[model samples]
Target: MRMIAAVMYEQGLPAPYAESSPLKIEEVELEGPGEGEVLVEVKSAGLCHSDLSQVAGLRKRTVPVVMGHEGAGIVREVGRGVTEFRAGDHVVMTVGSGCGHCSFCVNSRPVLCDTVAASRGKGVLTNGARKLRRNGQALFHHSGVSSFAQYAVTVPGTLVKIDPSVPLEIASMFGCAVVTGAGSVFNAAQVRPGQSVAVFGLGGVGLNSVMAAKIAGASTIIGIDLNESKLPLAAELGCTHALSALDPTLVEKVRDLTHGGVDFAFEISGSKAAMTTAIAVTRKGGEVVCVGLGASADLYQYAHTALVSEEKVFRGSLMGSCVPRRDLPLYLRYYQEGRMAVDRLMSGTMGFDQLNANLDLLDRGEVLRQVLLPNG
Candidate 1:
C-alpha cells in the first residue's frame, strides 16, 4: 500500500531550525507485516519534545529517520501466529519493540532493552537488517512505529490495546506524555494523601502530572511555567496553585506555601534552570523525579551527594514507568468516572499536515497539546 510519511536525511545542518530542513515527507509504499508484525492504520500521532530535538539537530540522529514514536491506531491486519490481537483493535504503540524472548522484555522493562542498538535504533526492518526505503534510497525509521504516516508495520509486542470509545486522536498523547507524567506520579513517586508536590512546566506532560497529583489526593499541587498564558489553564486542570517560573524566589515560594517543602517535585520543563528549581523545592527524604530529556549530555550539576546526605531520593523517570496495557485502562477509567479531566487539555484538533505548524505553536507556547487527528 502507498502511504505518506515524513522522511529525513543527513543533508542539512547548522541552519535555523525553521529553515534548516531536517526531513521531507510524501507518499511512499508501505510494506506488510512479517512473522510477528502487525499493520496498523495510524489514526493519530503525537508530537513530543524528543522529536523536536532530533528535528532541530540538537540531538544526534540516525538521520533519514521517520520522526514519530508516539502513535495510536487500529489493527488492520495481524501477522501469522499472532493470537493477541485481530483486525480493528484500537491500540497505542509502546515505543519499545522488545524481542519477547529477551530477559528485559519478559520483565516488562523493554524501554531499557539492549536491542535498541540493533533493531529500532538502527532503522532496520523487523529483521534488524532491511531499511524501509523508496526509489532505492534508505528511509530511516525513527522509533518503533515511525508514526508520522498513515500506516505502520510494527512488531506485535509493542502494541498496547486501548479502549475504542476513547478518541484515538486525544488518546495518542497518552502513548507518551500522559503515561510519562501520570506514571511518574502514581507508579514512580506514589505520593500519598495530603502530600505536597510541584510540576515545573505546564505542557501536556506537566499538566498530566498536576492532574494526577490532584487525583492522588495531594493537598498542594504547584504549577510552574514562564508562560503566564498557561496559568489559567493550569488552574482549570486541578492545579491548586501556580507561580511564574521566572520568580526568583520560586523555591522559597514553594517552601512558604507548603510549609517546609514539597514531598515531590517533577522536572517536566526540560529547562536546565527549571530542573534546578524542581530539585531545590523537594524536602528532606522527598523524591525529585526528572522526566524530560533536556539534552543527552546535560546533568543536574547540583550536589548528588547532598541528596544522599538529606536522604532525598533524586532520580529520573522514563515513559512514566508505564505498563501501558494496565495503565492506559486506568487512565481511561479515571477520565470516564470524572476522576481525571482531559477535555480541556486539547488545544486544537487538526489534520496530519498541520503537525509542523502545530509544533511551531508549541514553540510559541500557544497551546498545551496540539493533536493530529489522522482523519480530521
Candidate 2:
C-alpha cells in the first residue's frame, strides 16, 4: 500500500530544524505484515531526543530510515500464526524484540537479547527484513518500529495490547519515557515507600521519575536540571524540591535538602556530569540508577574505592529493565487509578506537517513531550 512517512535522507543537518527540514515527508510504499508480524495504523507518536540524536549526528544509523520508537497505534492487520493480537487492538510499541527461546527473552529481558540488539543497531526488524520502500528502493526500519509513518509493520514482540479507551496521545509516551523513567524507579531501584529520592534532568523521562517517586510515597523528591524553565513543570508533576544543576553547590544542596543524602538518585540526563552528580548525592550504601542514553563513546568516571567502601550500588537500566507485556498494562492501570500522571507529561500535539517545528522544540528542550498525529 502507499503511505506517507518522515524519512531521514541525511544526517548532520543545520539546526533550527523547523527551517532546515531534516526529515522529508514523502510518498512511500509499505508492505503488509508477513508471517508472525502485524501491521498497525500509527495514531500517536512522540518526538523523543533519541530520534533527535539520530538526525543531529549525536547517534549514527543507516540513512533513509523511518525514525520513531515511542508510539501507540491500532492494529489493522495481523499476519498468519499470530494469535496474541488481532485487528482493532490498541497497542504500545516497544523498542526491542527477541527470539522467544533465548535466555534473556525467557527471563523477560528482551533489550539484552542478541536478536534485538543486532537488528536495532542495523535499523532492521528482528528478522532482518526491510518492509519500507521508496519507489522500489529499500528503507531501513528504526528500532523495528519506524512509527513516524502513517502505518508500521512490526513483530508482535514490539507491541503490547492496551485498553482501547486510553487516549492514544498520552499512551504513546508509555512506550519510552514512562517505561524508562518509572521502570528505573520501580524495577531498577526497587524504591521503598517513604524513601528519599532525587532525579537529575527534568525532561520527559526525568519528570516521570519524579512522579514515580511520589507514587512510591517518597518523603523527599528532588528534581535537578540545567534548564530553569523545566523546574516548574517538575514541581507540578511531583517534585517536592527543584534546583538548577548548574549551581556550584548543587550536590551540597541535595545532601542538605535530604538531611544527609537521598536513598535513591536517578540520572536521566544522559550527561556524564549528571551521572557524576547522581552518584555524589546518594548516601552511604544508597542506590543510583542510570537511565540515560548518551553517545557510545561517552563514559562515567568516579573513584574506585567508593564502590567497595561505601557499598554504593551503581546500576545501568535499559528501558527500565522492563518487560513491556508485563509493565505497559501495569503503568496503564496506574494512570487509570490516577496514581500516574501520563496526561500532564504531554506539552503539545502536532501533525506531520509540523514535524520539523516540533523537532526543533525537542532539540532546544522547549517541550516535555509532544505527540505527532501521523494520519493528519
Candidate 3:
C-alpha cells in the first residue's frame, strides 16, 4: 500500500525546524501484517518530547525512520496467530511492547522487556522486520510503531484494544504521555491519601502526573516548570501550587509548602537540572522518579551521601514502569470517569504540512499535546 508519511533522514537539524525541515512528507510503501503482526489505520498520533529528542539528535535512532511512537487507530487486519484483536477494533499503539514470555513481561514490567530493548535499539519490529519503504529502499520503524502515516503494521504486544466510544485523538495520548506520567504516579510513586507530591516539568506528562496525584488523593501537589504558561494548566489539572522552576528559592518554597518536602517528586522535563531540583524537593525517605528522556550521555550528579543517609531513592521510570495491556485500560477508565481530565492537555491538531512548524512550537514550549491527523 502507498501512504503519505513523515520521514526523518537526519538528526540534529538546526532549530526553526519550520525552515530546516528535518521531516519530509512523502509517499511511502507499507507492507501487510505477517505472522503475529497487525495492520492499523492510524487515526491520531501525538507529537511527544521523545520524538523531539530524536529530531534534535538528543536521542539517536536509525536514520530514515518514520517518527512517531504514540498513536491510536483501528485494527484494519490481523495476521496469523493473533486472536486477541480483530478488524475494526479501536486500539492504542504503545512503544512499550514486550515479548510476553520475558521475565519483565511476566512480572508486569513489559516496558523493560529484553526483546523490546534490543529491537527498539535497532529501530525494527520485535521480530526484526521493517515494513516501511520508499522507492524500494527500506526505512526503519520508530519504536515499532512508525505511526506518522495513514497506516502502520506492528505486533500485537505494541497495541492495546480500547473502547470504540473514546475519541482517537484523546486516546492517542494514552500510548505515551498518559501511561508514562499517570503510571509514574499510580505505579512507581504509589502515592497514598494525603501524601505530598511535586512534579517537575508541566508538559503533557507532568500535567498527567498532577491529575494522577489528585486521583491518588495527594493532599499537596506542586507543579514546577520553566514555562510559566504551563503552570496555569497544571493548577487547573490538580496542582495545589504552581511555581516557576527558575525561582531562586524554589526548593525552599516546595519544602515549606509540603512541611519539609514532598513524599514523591517526579522529574519529567528531560533536563538534568530539573532532576537535581526534583531530588532536592523530595522529603527524607521519599522517592525521586525520573520519567523524562534526556541526552543519552548526559550524566546526573547528586549528593550520594544525602541519598544514603536520608534514605532517598532515585529511580528511573521507563514508560512509567507500565504493563500497557493492564494499565492503559485502567487509565482510560479514569479519563472516562472524568477524573483524569486529559482533554485539557490537547493544544490542537495538525496535518503533514504543519508538522515541522508544530515541532518548532513544541521545542519552544508554545504548545502541548498536539495531535497529527495523518489521515486527514
Candidate 4:
C-alpha cells in the first residue's frame, strides 16, 4: 500500500528544520506482515529525544528511513502462525525486538537480545527483511518500528496487547518514555516506600520517574533540568522538589533536600554532566541508575575510588530493564488508578504535517511530549 510518511534523507541539518526539513513527508510503499510479524495502522506516535538525536546525527541509522520508534496502533492484520492477535486489536510497540530463542530473551531481557539489537541498527526486521520502499527502492526501518508512517510492520514480540479503552495518543508514550522511565525506578532502582529519590532531566522520561517515585511511596522526589520551562511540569507531575541543573549548588541542593543525598539518583538527562551530578547526589551506598542514551563519543568520567570507598553502585538501564508484556499493563493500571499521569505529561498533540515543528520543540526541551496523530 502507498501511504504518506516522514522520511529522513540526511542528518544534522541546520536550525529551522522548516527550511532543511530533515524529515520529509512522502508517499511510500509499505509491505504487509510476513511470518511471525504483524501490520499496524499507527494511530499515534510520540516525538522522543532519541528521534531528535537521529535527526541531529548524534545517532546514525540507514538514511531514507521512516523515523519513529514510540507508537501505539491497531493491529490491521496478523502474519502467518500468529494466534495471539487479530485485526482491530489495540497494542503498544516496544523498541526491543529479540529472537525468541536468545539467552537474553529467555532471561526476560529482550532489550539486550543479541540478534534484535544488531538488526535494529541495521534498519531491518528481526528476520532481516525490509518492509518499506519508495518507487521500488528499499528504505530502512527505524529501530524495527518506523512508526512515523501511517503503517508499520513489526515482529510479534515487539508489541504488547493493551486495553483498547486507553487513548492511543497517551498509550504511545508507554512504548518508550514511560516504560524506560518508570522501569528504571521500579525495576532498576527498586525504590521502596518512603525512600528518597532524585531524577535529573525533566523530559518525558525523567518526569515519569518522578511520578513513579511518588507512587512508590517516596518521601521526597527531586527533579533537575537545565530547562526552567520543564521544572514546573516536573513539579506538577509529583516532584516534591524542583531545581535548576545550572545551579552551582545543584548537588549540594539535592543533598540538603534529602538530608544527605537521595537513596536513588536517576540520570535521564543523557549528559555526562548530569551523570556526574546523579552520582554526586546519591548518599553513600546509594545507587545511580543511568537511563539516558547520549552520544556514542561521550564518556562519564569519575573517580574509581568513590565506587569502593562510598560503596556506591552505578548501573546502566536499557528500556528500563523492562519486560514489556508485564510492565506495560502494570503502568496502564497505575494510570487508570490515577497514580501515574501520562495525560498531564503530554504537552500538545499535532498532525503529521507538524512533525518538524514538534521536533524543534523536543530538541529545545520546550515540551515534555508531543503526540502526532497520523490520521488527523
Question: Best TM-score goes to which candidate?
Answer: 3
Q: TM-score of each candidate?
A: 0.93, 0.97, 0.99, 0.97
Clashing pairs in 1: 8-64
For residues 4-39, what per-residue lDDT tens digits would candidate 1 score against the true structure? 787767633443434544546576667687777788
The C-alpha stretches of model 1 lying farther than 4 A from their native spots are 10-21, 116-118, 125-131
Global Cα lDDT for candidate 3: 0.93
Runs off by more than 4 Å, candidate 2: none
- After superposition on all CA atoms, what RMSD does each candidate show versus the true structure? 2.2, 1.3, 0.8, 1.2
Q: Could you give candidate 3's per-residue lDDT for residues 1-376 as a string of tens digits?
A: 9999999999999989999999999999999999899999999999999999999999788989998999999999999999999999999999977899988888888888989989998999999999999999999999999889999999998999999999999999999999999999989989999999999989999899999999999999999999998888888899999999999999999999998999999999878889889888999999999899889998889989999999999888998889898899999999999999988999999999999999999999988899999999
TM for candidate 2 is 0.97
User: What is the model-wide C-alpha lDDT for candidate 4?
Assistant: 0.89
Pairs that clash in candidate 2 = none
Candidate 4: tens digits of C-alpha lDDT, residues 170-233? 9999999999999999989989999999898888899889989988899999999998878887
lDDT of 2 by residue, 1-376 (tens): 9998999989889989988899999999999999999999999999988888888887788878998898999999999999999999999987945667789999888768987888888888988888999988899998999889999999998999999889998899999989999988988898888899999989988888898888888989999988999998889888899999989999899999987788999988788888888889999989888888888677779878987899899888998888888888998999989988889889988888898888888888888899988996
User: Residue 107 error for model 1, in Å?
Assistant: 3.7
In terms of lDDT, the poorest run of 10 residues in model 4 is 93-102
Which pairs, if any, clash in model 4? none
Best by lDDT: 3
